[model samples]
Target chain A: MTFSVEVNGVEHTTEPRPGQCLRTYLRERGCFGVKKGCDSGDCGACTVHVDGVPVHSCLYPAVRAGGHAVTTVEGLATAGELHPVQQRFLDAQGFQCGFCTAGFVMTTAALDEAQLADLPQALKGNLCRCTGYRAISDAVRGVTTVETACPGRAVGASVAAPAGPQVVTGTARYTLDVDVPGVLHMKLLRSPHAHARVVAIDTADALALPGVQAVFTHEDAPRRRFSSGRHENPADDPADTRVLDDVVRHVGQRVAAVVADTEAAAEEGCRRVRVTYEVRPAVTDPEEALRPGAPLVQATGNVVGEVHGEVGDVEAGFAAAAAVYERTFHTPRVQHASLETHGAVGWLEADDSLVVRTSTRSRSSPAARCATCSTCPPSRCGWWRAASGAGSAASRRCSSRTWSRSPCCNCAGRCAWSSPAPSSSSVPPRGTRSPCA
Target chain B: MDLHTVEQWVDARTVDAWRPGDAWLAGGTALFSAPGVHLRRLRDLGGTGWEPLVEDPDGRLEIAATCTVARLAAHPVALFGQCCRAFLASFTIWNMATVGGNLCAALPAGPMIALTTALDGGCLLLAPDGAARTLPVTAFVVGDGRTALREGELLRSVTVGPLPARTAFRQASLSTLGRSAALLIGTRDADGAMTLTITAATPRPHRLRFAVPPTAGELREAVEDEVEHWFDDLHGHPAWRRHLTFRFAEQIREELS
Candidate 1:
């Protein structure tokens, strides 16, 4: 539907796609500052001012935004001058990673003097993963005062992040914010049963979907195994999972991948990809899993690895002690819940060399991961790495540096490279003014 | 994902226009919160132009269906503010979710239902052919996600209490900043009668009334007799909810007494 709406004091009329939300509309129009932490309203990362009241744009329909004045994080800085809240955020160094910064800035900017008294309750809508709420609270309350005093030595003095201004003003772009043309969205079809043997996969219907480009099943996937861990030595952890596995060991394990022109089409394509599985009994409890008659989760006897190191002399130490105490402890599983979920964008270059943009502890780890998939089979075998710029000279033999990630023949002559952004060299441009036409 | 099935948006002005696949859009909080596959059209209620809050000569307050939680929270009425906080929702939700919508959603733990029911509130239902009907808040909400709202009927406004120098008590339980496990509200009417409305623990709001502040044992027995359908979800168990309900019932009775 074509409609005129005032965004950042400028009016524009455009046709919004079917069932589009205000967040998608603004972001598509180059308001990159409108972050999408959780597409649902729970995260409040897409909070923006609609008629000067804060609302979660992710859930607000684009159609409802018509004839109303909308303000985003990008609009907070006028005439190259940051608003007071943005300035306060910069002074407080209120953010790390900066994905959720725009939402916080927008929500904070909408707060009036009266609301400032209850900063904690007023700002409950927004969430930050890297930095706690104190720094954000300080930004609104005008604390931290931009301490520039290099008292005695640099070690004790608080140093401002070089990108602090950009972060505070929502001018910095994260990896997901990077625009890529002709990028196919992917959706995974996971195993519904915890323990099952994949009998066969029928991807004929999914591949026939109009927008679906490819449907990858275990039949066509590489049989190589690779460790998920980032330990320097590959032997430190067992290489259990394959890119696609025939045996479904756990629920929610990737069974197939569907790539399509759009997210909806990709999801639909995933739904259409049928699979036949032979259900097997599974034990979820630790003690039950250790029982002699329990079903094996792994072919190598459920136990992946064991530590047998002795500390001094166990019996002698306990014998000498007046009292003995022992307990087996367990901790609940927790998620990082990072504002920015881990993702990678990979595409083949002009000469079929991979260029991937992803984040990992080690730069070459992605290449190393890709290398293991192509070189090492399910059985115990040595693997190699393919460094970027190796191009056509990509080595088939193992290299000393084990972390390089170069795609091989199984990649269908495609590869990806990774990089970071928003440094001095890169800038999140103030997109074309209004595009009022 | 978006609500792919929605094909039309209607700026609805009255209850007579209601259709099979139509959903009333007030604040759009609950409607837009999830993808409703069955929904084919949104009937916009924003154009209704109803006054949010109004006080008559008798001092009875009328709250429109469109009055958002955040707006209601700012009202001087102590019960309104307390009920608003019971949602435990963030600022954005408070800024958008409506009182009428909350009562209509009919969730067992809906604080609006608890507040209105405890204060002797009545819902004005605008029927087709320009007729208006009134139902007590307790009768309006039947059970979980179910309401007495009939076909082509619109919830116009809710009128609550002259209150008459009444003192109110509210107690809500939750592990963290999440859904309420049990919420119980008590009010001392002008006649010196104690009215306790129990929610969150049960599938529907249970009201217990005593001519005089009931004895601790009487309040416990009344709660046990009235509240039967307790939720056994992550929020709480039947026995646990019953225990909290009895304990809170006595506390509210004592506080009001």
Candidate 2:
């Protein structure tokens, strides 16, 4: 349903689905400052002011934001004027990649001068992967005055102080504050067991649920697999994932997706989805997966690949050292917990091309290659062909060099015909070690 | 907004006028962090036109339930003001959090609860029946994330007696940016009577009062006997909490005397 919301003193009527988060709604409305890092509430990247109070937009339901004022990083400055907090961040160089800047600004703006003095506690919820928090703290402290010229000024500048009923007296608009139209709520049916093979699936009950619009299973989805992994050439890697798969590898892995008129309906549809699984022994421990007797997590065994690159011989280096400290530092898997959860809105064009608006790590590559090649599987194995082709060429060159080194080359009188002529003048002479070598 | 929708705001004002499914909105710091909360609606009880700060007629201090920690740090009360300054460890979101919010949120390591219980403060509880009752700060917090607040009741304000002429506060945490693992507050009255309050180590505040300065053995026994359950979490274990409670209790008692 469409609802009216006032953001930064402007009112707009928009439609929003119950499960649709405020962060996605605001981004769709062209507020790109709201970043999505981790879809979980751990990271404050999606922080925005809801009724003047700072909140993680990812956790708040868009429907709950109806008739409320939302404030984002774009609204911090008044008509090209910067709020003191934003200026402070700029002066202190509080941000690096700029993804987390909006959250810091929104959180800082919510605090008063006294609270700003001791900020470690106040800003604890807002985590920055970069800068180690020194500059952020400085920025928060540097902006003593409340007003400035634009949203990008230094904290030290003198501007009109933020004067309102109370500093955060409940009138801020956030991304979730937007009310959209014709929105459909979506939910995913996740696997209960860690690893299992889907033997039978049923979705008729889910489609019959009230307000249910669509139910997608592996049978209805594209057969091609895609890689969700984030890397430079994701297609070259083990792109083993599919939109919906018969085999579930992780407990939280999506088995099916349901779109409904309401979030509650979508949730009900998710519950109605029935799937019979042949549960398998799951391997959660990465170390155990490498052991000899451990159950293989993947068909090709659990070892993804080992990274071993050395500039010099490690044994020689260790032997030369008077004292060696060899210790393994284990870092547990940590969720990014970005305030904006991972979500995408996809619409199929009349031409059959899909227009997907999603928060993804891979945004630089071309869409077609990224979606089909980088994300698609089976074609990823083609990377092995490329690597082997280079290796074969290198081995052929080495064997020809060894043949040319033989003393029989001159006796047999086959040296000239046996070895191919150098392709360029830069190539070294076969008999002599040329300076170019 | 109409009362029907207003009942869902969850602030100090709405907390006082609570209907069903209403919970007090403190800083909205903790409540907003948790997803799928049991509360269907929030009654906004924040900044409800109440006086944020007030000094009592007898030279004591009474702060509004909605007053932020930032305000308390600058207030005139010595013990409370010092505790408020130390409480600055959690300052980034302090501007919106209220004194009552901190107390009612009832995290064992909550700095405000340690401060109030240390000062022998009392909470003014306004029940939905239009009757008001007062409970000692030590008795108010029942357990972690738990409080003595009855349904449809609100904590109006926290009242602290004037510093007993001389008072000192000491608190410690595990990390530089960590919550307190243990907190100790000691006060000496004019008649040579001393009171030592140990918190952050137990589910409830452990307060020991002495007509005369107590010995180390007496202090240790009082702490062990008074505090029912020692707190344990990611911050510190229950055994460590008990050990530090006794250690700090003796330190504060000697320092106050």
Return the TM-score for each candidate structure: 0.84, 0.67
Report the lDDT tens digits of candidate 2 across residue range A308-373: 788889999999999999999998765333232333333332333333332222223324322442
Q: Second chain of candidate 1: TM-score?
A: 0.94
Q: Tell me the spans in candidate 1 whose CA falls farther than 4 Å from its real position.
A: A145-152, A308-314, A374-437, B4-7, B13-22, B37-40, B54-62, B123-135, B139-157, B175-177, B236-240
RMSD (Cα, Å) of candidate 1?
Answer: 7.5
Local accuracy of candidate 2 as per-residue lDDT tens digits, B1-257: 00112113333443244556566655455555444324556655544777777777786667788787767776766766666655533343454456887898788778788888877888999887769999988889878888899887879998887668688677777776567788888889999989888778777676788999888888777776787788888888888877777777777877877
Interface RMSD of 1: 2.2
User: Over the full model, what C-alpha lDDT does candidate 2 score relative to the true structure?
Assistant: 0.60
Give the DockQ-based CAPRI class for model 2.
incorrect
Give model 2's DockQ, 2 decimals: 0.12
**A1-437 per-residue lDDT for model 1 (tens digits):** 35889999989788555466788889878887787666767777788999998999887878778889999988878898889888888888777666688898888888878768987667777888766777788888887745664756767567777667767666665534656666666667888999899998999999899888777777756677766443557777787767678988778777877777776677778878889999999878877888998999887887777788888999999999999999989997554565543344555444434444432323354456665664322232211111111111112212211212211222321112211110111222222111000
Give candidate 2's error at residue B126 in angstroms: 5.2
- Each model's lDDT comes to 0.71, 0.60
**Fraction of the native A-B contacts that model 2 recovers:** 0.13
**In model 2, what is the error at residue A87, expressed in angstroms?**
6.0
